[model samples]
Target: MPANNPPDQPPTPGQEPDRTIAYRQHNDQPYPQGYPQQGAYQQQGQPGYPQQGAGGYQQDGYQQQNYGQQVQPGYQQQGYGQQQNYGQQAYGQQAGYQAGHQQPGYPQQNYGQQPSWQQGSDFLGTGQPTAPPAKKGRKGWLFAVIAALVVALVGGGGAFAVNLLSGGGTQPHDVLPGDALGYVRLDLDPAANQKLALFSIAQKFTVTKSSFTGDDPRKALFDLLKKDGAGLDKVDYAADIEPWLGQRVGLAVLSPAKTGGEPGFVLAVQVTDETKAKAGIDKLMDGDKYGIAFRDDYALLTANQDQADQAVKAAPLSQNTNFSDDLNALGETGVLSFWVDAGRVASFAPELAAQNSEALAQIKNVRVAGALRFDGDYVELAGVTRGAQNLDMGQPEASKIGALPASTAAAVSFSGLGDIIGKQWAQILKSADQSGAGVQQFATQAEQTYGLKLPDDLTTLLGKNLTLALDSNGLDGDQPKFGARITTDPAKAQEVVGKIEKFLAASGTAAPQLAKVPGDGTFVLASSQEYAAELAKDGGLGDDESFKLAIPDADNATFAAYVDLDKLEKFYLQNLQGEDKANAQVLRAVGISGTQSGPDASFSLRLLFN
Candidate 1:
């Protein structure tokens, strides 16, 4: 169909002009041709070479020569097969060599298989063919190593994200503070907090939900820092020395011995950036006696240089045995921690000690430590008080303490209230006399009011383990119904209830319904006989899993209490309207529990909210 014919006059060998094949990407575009296209050639009957096409040889019968290969003698001249079917059988014949005769490592030629000429397949070489040049093994191995490194980097980054999301590791306690009557530490950046404080205060006038898109608490802080703590109206706190003007800072109340004269305090900051922190302090001091002292990266400031030096030289709070023990008991990583040396505080503040001498004397040997942690929907604060031998804060007992009924809204349990009451009876009587309750002569008053002879000593009716509870669970119709329950020795409880009944009869009022748990040693103070009877049938809180979770380790607890804030919040909200109701904040529950070892006591309060 297509025209193809030889030229009428073939050029003589020496007079032939050189020619080139040109390639154009589009019909309209012309590009100069590059290299001269050479024809392919193959020898017939060569052991590993392809066969000649159907044309066999040219009319002149001269042996064909390969474009770049040396030609062997006795081969017939041949034209190349169609290039579009390059890998197909040449002119209808298969390659000359049989499949089994392939070189030891050479790939077998298949139907339509392209010739790998660039792989240096030298057909002229001693009857052997070369295998594809060994792939760049070193380059492949290098790429594999790089791929592994990329995977490791990606995995490490993911791990870091997980750690940050899970609340990254806690640093060691701020050990810059020295021994003092009181010491406080916070796991926060003081500089950041100062910025946050300024931002929050300014937000009242300058910030609004629609205008501010960023929620990071530090954005405003950074802006405030740039402003040089200015623009705060009416005595800006940031303008003054933010004592906690560093990454970590603490306050310590040093005794007179360490303070040089007056009982003074020092603010110690862990200086992350010395230049910035120092500038802040300089602006605050303004030539006052309080100056900054640097110990390495830590900066201390106090009323005088001596106090600052004392804070630097004295033993750190981290090394204090009692304080560290208490800190561990509360949670080492809590947001805030504080310790109070009761003896030191009393000695430092003698004026207050003189006013409350008796009460102070009782707790003079106490060492108090507390910690605060803020979890989602929960704020927990725990305190530990380690007292000296003389304080006689009772020890735990093996027997179970009073267990309040499940319907209770709030309850308090204490170990041996009787012993403490007896020890402080005189102070108790004095306080009652001052209050007009006349408890100093309670026996006489009881006899006159109830027409019954009361025990001369009030301790006779008391029990070692006591529990008192209030029930407002039945609150409705804006009027809260209140019920009270007390647990102690069954015999002692009966005696006290009888005395109260007699007093009610003498007053000519309806006697309050009283019911007792059959074998649980608890008395229910109910609004009616029917309610009291109903209360006796329910299980106690001690058997409830939710109650146990609220107050854990009850066996060793010296005192424990649980408050159902949900019920309390509902009761209060029911009586409120409009803004009052909208602004009301409620917690899920609050559990306060304590443990006493010898004279030392530790207490924790767990507050849960919605």
Candidate 2:
């Protein structure tokens, strides 16, 4: 036996501490001096803590048991019923205190259940209990919103990557002759992302979307071809063309066999199935006018069998060094591309050769290439002319049109006009009049009638930089405000103005007003004096947001142009109605810019969208 007679004191040697006494002490309630007697403890199912009885421990709403008896069905026992046992009973469980099962009228809870005092119970003073605060509702909508954002970001990023990296398909140069004089290719089947973009952009307007009834752009084009005089009325697209037709088609103008013979052409069409393509061509063409021959993945169509055979036998355009180099300089080849061998073309055409022999001889090695590309917000047509040195246009200089007013509706600026006119006047006149006598007579007549030097006065008037601008404010009235500002010597410009005034007076026509812009070495010729003064003011057009968006590289452009479609829409679209007017409104502006570098020159024309 162990000694434990004291109240609220530690147990004696070898004696177990009573959990009932510990629980009561934890709640700041006094423990009995000795073992509790039967019926002396609190009544069963009371709100306060459990107490030890003489026969067994009991709590409110719990069954009584003798010390040596087994636990009742409504209660669980770990130590009290059998001898010398002392472990905690599971709380908030059904019947015998097992996990995940609840007792009668008791809320279900995990093993780490809090004591009654901390579980919203008034057992410390009022002897009553309350339910735990209701749990908060789950925030499912927040998670859903997060998931949607994640998907959008991932999907958008993937699409952007595909648009930049995807290659549409085989190009036309893959099959054309290496030494062809010129080539034009149309790519109906582009990359997946490009096709999707084209479809989406087209669908934005009511007019364009009407033709694109389905997702297949190629089918729509074939349907259109069948309706027009495309000569495909007898053929069925689903059964005849779609069976073997590929995505790309190219037309090449071959050089003449000798200098005087006429140039021939070869049409190369991409084909997936050669047998079907051959059969389709037989049905579509007459033997006397057209011929077909297959090489690699393309079917070559020509005027005759011999030309078709020869085109296939020749080296492909992909292998031509000059053609490849020029195309590579042009960057991405888009839905449409064209290449011209200037030297070969000039050599083949007798009329062009006779008219400008000197110019043609100098451009014997030059080539010109261009492409058209589409984007989500804009469409761009870009071109490049290689070997520009052979036909020297003039040194490129940046245009100074950015000083025009922000209200400018349209403007075109050019540099090096004087140099081109001064150096090429004689050659130009010779080309226009091979006999040379007619041009001489015209010059003499002009000089005699106007009393001014011919080319000298013209070159001085044009100067280095010339810009023509139309202001939006002028469009409100019958006579629109417009002017041309030219960079030149003020005194010389005034002299030219005087000569023009005299000529206008002699002809009995009204003379236009011309004056120098204050502080700047430029002259403005306008419809009226007030408009000329407005043109002289610093308007900061270059710094305007719309102008910058339209002409991104205006600072480096030798030649540049801008037109505000929004400002001009009222004049051009006033008569349009319904879908046509709405579709036409999609265009916001157009910008053109060009640059020249030694033997290479490039230009870009872009149409911006709303």
For candidate 1, write residues 382-435 as lDDT tens digits. Answer: 777776656554654422333445667777777656666766666777667866
Which segments of candidate 2 are over 4 A away from where they belong? 1-166, 215-234, 286-291, 304-306, 435-439, 446-450, 514-518, 527-534
Location of the lowest summed lDDT over 10 successive residues in candidate 2: 113-122
Predicted structure 2, TM vs. truth? 0.68
For model 2, how does the per-residue alpha-carbon lDDT over 1-610 read when each residue is reduced to its tens digit? 0011121134443322322111223222322222121112122443433443322223335443333233444443322111111245332121111212222343432223211111112121122224331222232232232222222211222122222223333466777888889999776544322343343344344433322111233455667677887787777777887789876789999877788897888999989999999887776673447867888789999988888888889988877888777776775555678999887787777887887778778788789999776554566788899974455676757886787888899999988887778788888787658755587676777688876776777777888888899999869788888988887776787787777788889889976555445337777788777888878766788997667767767888778899989989998677765545666687788998888766778898887766
Query: Per-candidate TM vs. native?
Result: 0.57, 0.68
Error of 2 at 302 (Å): 3.0
Off by over 4 Å in 1: 1-177, 189-245, 257-262, 351-361, 396-403, 430-438, 442-462, 470-473, 477-492, 501-524, 530-546, 574-586
